[model samples]
Target: MVHENKHVKNARYVRTVESMFACPVCRASMKVVHYQSLICSNHHTFDFAKRGYINFMNQPVNTKYSKGLFEARRKLMTEEAFFEPLSHAIASAIHAHVAKPKKTSSILDMGCGEGTLLSTICNKVSSRGIRDVIGAGSDISKAGIAMASKNYSDKVWTVADIANPPFKESQFDVILSILSPSNYAECNRLLRTGGIVVKVVPRSGYLKEIREVLFHKATKKYSNEATLERFSKHFQVAEHFRLCYTTRLNPASMKWLVQMTPLTWSLTEEKEMSLAEEISNQITVDLDVMIGISPK
Candidate 1:
């Protein structure tokens, strides 16, 4: 049986009601009725199937991310534990940055694949009683968001394009982008004046073990200085942390392991076949986590 997040089950229905309505066409005000579709005053409407998620992509999103890919990602995350350190890093950053007491904290996780990082942070916050979280997880992949919404029923999960998210201006106090593409202009529009954006990008050495096996060469592009420089163009840099951790992946996780990565797309058929045979037993896990804050 699939394990669902119980915190989602315990949340008040009112929270779910308020969280579901975001206009798909205009990204403006919407009213959700019958737990199905959200309709805006402009007459634009979006439907949420019985599984519990709404698709808000204005134009067709052309990509390889599918239901199988997201399921593989979720399975790999749960089995290989790729996000354990990442989650702690995010929670710690939030605790360190939010100095003042807040009545509620709003977090918008863009390109949130299967809701692993966001769900982990929410569980941490609830367990510690740091603050009530209005956690919203969005992705361009409708299948991904649908899976996330079903598993994390309480979160405001939507099939939203990161380049143009469906929400009002300056709504989120914290935005997260983990190992995914980001639209800085849209992110800036969605965040409050002094909100924070925590990003996790792979360093050169990240998953060196996997790269070493999967391909002949892999780039260690997008240096920290470069990232900070790019982000500084929009928001001030608050703090930087270099996070690295090593863990071993079990044999059962190897298939999902390959499916869970960008490497899946990067590797050639011959190289992928070779990599699959090389370490069918176990493999190493490596990654980096970075955080930036909005201007005060």
Candidate 2:
């Protein structure tokens, strides 16, 4: 593997981060220190891991994003090849919205699971001669953020709450939220006046094979209407499209999918075992990519 000076590299990350965050407790400026935490003048401190990510959330957390869930997500994502098309869609959308003659720009991937999508976008942008773009991703799960930081040390990865991003206001050019929750007011607070928010949600028939095994009856809940309602409240549409792809999942990956995805959480032990037995090979994969622009 590769190892470099975290402190020196972190200085670059801190420079950009200070531009996207405010003190959640006091709304003052926060600074990045070698301790890997964001500290305010009032002495409210957050901890950063050896992997080079800091958790800016103030209080305790009680979400389903435990270490096990993050671990399962990593294993499945790495093995199942779920990110290729999604990354392409993200890169295409970013290219459409980004302007030229820019120095170092920033993109924050909120609820970035394992940093795959952001890393892919950065590499693609760099290939197109935009060497100064940065891909920063943050998640509530420490393990998730830790894995991302360790693997993609070249980028800025943090364990920050999007509700209160640990960076300055009006600093990011693009904010991405894929298969995660969003707070549009917070997103607007982070973006520049003309910045963009690229969000990805599941379409009507996303992950049907997994859903079939996990639930006896499945209903379409994550529709474009629900997301558009939220986005309309804060953002205007610059461009929008749907990305659809079909792929097959292996056995181990299929099992990991069952555990990692929220769809199977309600399944009983007996039902889960039966579902596992019923699966042989290949599960369907589908998702949508939505791109929106902040009102200038």
Candidate 3:
């Protein structure tokens, strides 16, 4: 048997969902040409990387998230099962809300870091009987997308900006924003009329152990009131679920916990080392999973 490289496999998969994409430059429909490049109707083109992900941004945009951060995050999510309950909850929300007359669905994860949440949710949804599901993940961080493509080759991975996503309007049945920033308007444009958006936001107690070590008393407490208000402004919230749990981590997982979040970004090398050592073995995972239907 001839072996196909990652690029070949990804290009073939993109061909199946080619209509879901719009040229980032021309906003025209795109099709995979010669199993290598995605060419638009107006002749604009984007090539797939050898690692099986597409870079949709015309210019490079640097972010604070690095390869090491995403790697550490992947370890915590995959090895430590840090967000297992949250992933299952999101899958349940999708199964409950999304219509299944055709028995098929398309899901897009905006600001998907390392693609673990999206990939896990996809599997859970499929296990729930939605076998014909298409999963796509996008993040501004090229490093995150690269890691995602390498690990989850079955799904489409793209380095894209959430604020201005490069996709056709009303092409997705569900849009997910997991502990990441969201652009409600872009989500509205991306979802079908009756489609849903599942957004996960951190509550006050989320990562409280780490927060206590990294911040002053005033800055340690976190709130999602403003975020909920903004989400409600754009969509009619169908369901609101709060998930809270505690999980114990080993020393290596604790190290990953410190590196996986932006909360520790402000700490110096010495302070970071001290803070990592200070964090306890138990960590809290408190979150709000909101399912909203676009008013459009």
The global C-alpha lDDT for each of the candidates, from Candidate 1 onward, is 0.71, 0.73, 0.89
> Lowest summed lDDT over 10 consecutive residues: which window, candidate 2?
212-221
Error of 2 at 136 (Å): 2.0
Clashing pairs in 2: 19-168, 20-167, 20-168, 21-167, 21-168
Q: Give the TM-score of candidate 3.
A: 0.96
Backbone clash tally (model 1): 0
- Model 1 C-alpha lDDT per residue in residues 124-164, reported as the tens digit of each score: 75555555788888888877877887788767877777876
Candidate 3 lDDT by residue in tens digits, 162-279: 8768799999999999888889999999999889999998888988888776664533466788888989999999998889999999888988888888988877768766787888
The candidate scoring highest on TM-score is 3
Each candidate structure's TM-score, on Cα atoms with residue i matched to residue i, is: 0.85, 0.85, 0.96
Clashes of each: 0, 5, 0
Question: What value does the lDDT take at residue 243 in candidate 1?
Answer: 77
